[model samples]
Target chain A: MANKVLVLGEVREGALRNVSFEAIAAAKQIADGEVVGVLLGDSVANLAGELIAYGADRVVTVEHPHLKSYTSDGYSQAFLAVCEQEKPEGIILGHTSLGKDLSPKLASRLNSGLISDVTEIEGAGEDAVFIRPIYSGKAFEKVKIKEGIVFATIRPNNIKPLEKNASLTGDVASISVDVQNLRTIIKDVVRKASTGVDLSEAKIVVAGGRGVKSAEGFEPLKELANLLGGAVGASRGACDADYCDYSLQIGQTGKVVTPDLYIAAGISGAIQHLAGMSNSKVIVAINKDPEANIFKVADYGIVGDLFEVVPMLIEEFKALKVNS
Target chain B: MNIFVLVKRTFDTEEKIVISNGKIQEDGAEFIINPYDEYAIEEAIQVRDAKGGKVTVLTIGGEDAEKQLRTALAMGADEAVLINTEDDLDELDQYSAAYILAEYLKDKEVDLILAGNVAIDGGTGQVGPRVADLLGINYVTTITDLEIDGTNVKIVRDIEGDSEIIETSLPLLVTAQQGLNEPRYPSLPGIMKAKKKPLAELELDDLDIDEDDVEVKIEIVDIYLPPQKAAGRVLEGELSQQVKELVNLLHSEAKVV
Candidate 1:
């Protein structure tokens, strides 16, 4: 049976988030019929062309006054309406804060199954299997929907977006939605000071652990991250020690990140911490301890004081960039 | 006020997992009440203590899970319940788990229910909200702070790097996040009291849920360890030399530069 998979495009700060394109890429694998992108928010119609360029075959825009900001109730109601109208066989969304909050409600309302934070997809058609980290990335599980609409939220940065084709065009249809009786209202969204890149979506991440010593120890890591156009993260040790905020903690209890390149500075690889970043394409560990667990998972291990090593690498990177 | 906390038995976060024949090896693995769920249990105890209520911890698992339920009780819960599904069901997914939980909770006078933001083993973070949806109540996840005053609830929920303040009525559910509070260790007296606390073991038949109605909607196809990365190349020499060599490798081999 041909499956029309709906890709939910996420918009943040008047722009399409990278995960929107990544979800479209994931949808392509299971979509045998049409890859339809569903955009819900005020003034989202303009983003349809971007979704199409990233691989959506068609776009459905749900615009309403109440839909301007994200509330679980509003998005759920709008998304449920789209699902009912389109009758999609599958729905793919980014495993983001918005998606995490909305997907479960929608799934329950639709009485469907959902696999969250899926990192890989194998096979295709009705038998499409999803690979997700379970036991906190210590192990992986392959799961399949038994019946009803197939719903999944892909972890960002894991799925590469399809090649963009500017020539590709798709029909954009606007639908009116009634988003009322919301129990929760988003009066405002206070984002953390824009740190250039989203930690979860950054291509490269420079993370620190307790060995960073103090809050000031993060300065070098931050500088290196900023230079590389990446993000800075911390281990639970650092967060617990008050070296950094819990928001930057990456571990079993914190955010799970999988970047193209992961730099663990002064982080001893606890299983909890590894659960968050072990899947990074290439791991580089810089620690004074040669036997640090982080080295077990790293592709390159530098047994030296990160304070001395990080500054040196920063200079070399600067020179390398200038030469290039 | 009647407070309920949903707990799960998961592998200790520090345990090194071993997969044999496509399944996690659990013969000697240590099982603990999920660390996140401990936050829920502690929060439930605090809420009950602050505002006159009885805290009851619940779990849907085998008899072995009684150990975890006991731990919750030892942490100050007034009662515990184990909905044993060991014999009736071979597999339990989030949907089925939520269905069973909702069925059990639907008739109860639930003022507030708490659970972890996500279980480490499954990490779906779906059960609490799914149960809320089924019971037609307001719910929130990743809550860092929760305050209740005579049916009016105020909460601060974690959203990525930021936080959101939400106000809702009672008869609510919230999943506990890491920053919610530091969970307390069970005292010797609390452990002794937990031994005599009401620990009821029920089954699917007791909940009046038919086997077919609560069937799992998803199937696990395989379980395996992630492919191991090749051993790391340790750069030998002084700090400066290692940094120089590391940058060279990043540029020439890793191509990350």
Candidate 2:
């Protein structure tokens, strides 16, 4: 059966996040029918053109004062209203903070099946299979929805967005939704110092482990990351030792990241830590110990003190940019 | 106050996952109570100790899961319950699991329920919120600190890089985050006490839920290991030379720079 798939566009700081476009790409794969983009936030109607430029056939806008900030209750109620009216056969959303909080609740309310953090989609129609990581990244599971609506959240950077066509246009329709009696409310969103790139969505990530020694040791890694237009991460050991904040930790208990390039500096790759970043396209490990387990998974290994090696590499990169 | 902590038995995080014939090989593998759920269990015990309540650890699994329930009991839960689904079900998903749990708790006098932010194995982070939704109760996820006073609850939840403070009333559910508390190890005495503690085993019939009503919505089509990473090219020589070679490879080979 041809399925109308709804892609929920995510907005941050009044602009569409990159994952929104990535979600449109994922929705295009599952959607044999119309691909509709659903935008829910204050003044989100103007963002529909961007979704249309990617791949959405039409856009549905739900703007309300209550949805200015993302609260699970409020977003779920708004999304559920959109689902009820559209009765989409499938739903695709970014596997982000907002998606993680709202997808499960919406799926439960609709009695639908959900595959969260899906990295790939295979087949089509009723036979469509969604692939997601299990046991962290140690294993992958391909799941299918047996009945009801097919709901899935796509991890950012895994699915490439469709090329933009400025000529393409879609009908933008406004919908009235009654968002009321929310059990939870977001009085305000306290954003951390806004970095250029989201660590989870960055194309390149430079991570430090216990060998970084102290919080100050992260300076070189941060410099390399900044040069590469990326973000910085840390292992649980670094965070546990108070070398870095838990927010920067990437491991079994921390945020799972899959970037195009991952540089592990002074990290003795523990299984818990490998569970998070082993999926990166290219992994580079820098450690003085040649026998370090991180080398087992890295594409490139450098056996040297990160302090000396990192500064040298940074200088080399700088020289390359200047010469080019 | 009456507290419940939901626990699950998962493969040890350190165990190398092996998949055979499209399923995880479990024979001879070590299993432990999910590490995150340990934090939930510990938090429940502390709450019970301070607020004058009993903590009951619950799990929905087969007979093998009793070990995990016992571990939770050993960690200081006052009671334990194992909702055995071995005979009646072939598959289970988050929705079905939450449905069964909500049905069981709907009639119980529950003030607060605690669960891990996400099971390490599935990593979905869905069950706690789904159960709260099913029971029509308020819930907070990834909570680092929780304090209860009378009927009001104050919670600090992790939000990526920051934290958010929320205020709500009782009949609440919260998922324990990493920084919540240090989980206590099972002492010898605690282990012996756990062996004698009341561990009740119930079935779908006991919870008044039918097998069909709680049927799994999603189907597992295949399970397999991720593609293996190739052996790394270990760059040798002095620090400067290694750095030179690394940058050269990053530019020409990996094309990353």
**What is the C-alpha DockQ of each candidate?**
0.72, 0.67
Clash pairs (backbone) in predicted model 1: none
Worst 10 residues of 1 chain A by lDDT: A185-194
Q: Quote the positional error of residue B233 for candidate 2 in Å.
A: 0.6
Candidate 1 docking: what grade? medium
Computed on C-alpha atoms, the DockQ of candidate 1 is: 0.72
Runs of candidate 2 exceeding 4 Å displacement? A193-196
In candidate 2, the residue pairs with backbone N, CA or C atoms under 3 Å apart (3 or more residues apart, or in different chains) clash, namely none
lDDT of 1 at A243: 90
Find the candidate with the highest TM-score and give its number. 1
- Best candidate per lDDT, number? 1
